[model samples]
Target: MNHGAFRPIELRAPEGSVVDVRDDAPAGAHGEVRKRAVSVALGALSQIIPDLVSGDLCGTSFPNAIGE
Candidate 1:
């Protein structure tokens, strides 16, 4: 089965931006940072693919596990 023609794809993170945070701010707080980033990304993706992502996003059972 032919998949189809190739299409160009590009992904970039700006310098010093939150999407690509600098090293000096906080290394230990990466867990919080990661959650925020995922929310932003998944929020965007859900708009286009809501069904696939519907049940994928949920609250953590162990809320305090990540210092949240």
Candidate 2:
């Protein structure tokens, strides 16, 4: 096996946040963990709720707002 050619990679979270895990977790588990972590973080932020629910925070300008 050519071990020299392999390198460890560091994963990064999106621009506005930090990642909690970088180990060899499965894709589905990673996604669920990330989703729950994001939900909790955003829930703590609180003010982002309306914009998240409204979908206009991203500047797409939701025509009907959520749950219309």
Clash number for each model: 0, 0
Over 6-68, each residue of candidate 2 has an lDDT whose tens digit, in order, gives 345355576434354434533434444555555655565567545433112322222332442
Q: Report the C-alpha lDDT of model 1 over 1-68, residue by residue, as the tens digit.
A: 25744333454889687657787754665566666666766788789978655333353333344665
Instruction: Name the lDDT of candidate 1.
Output: 0.60
Off by over 4 Å in 1: 1-11, 54-68
RMSD, every candidate, angstroms? 6.2, 15.3
In model 2, the runs with Cα more than 4 Å from the true position are 1-28, 47-68
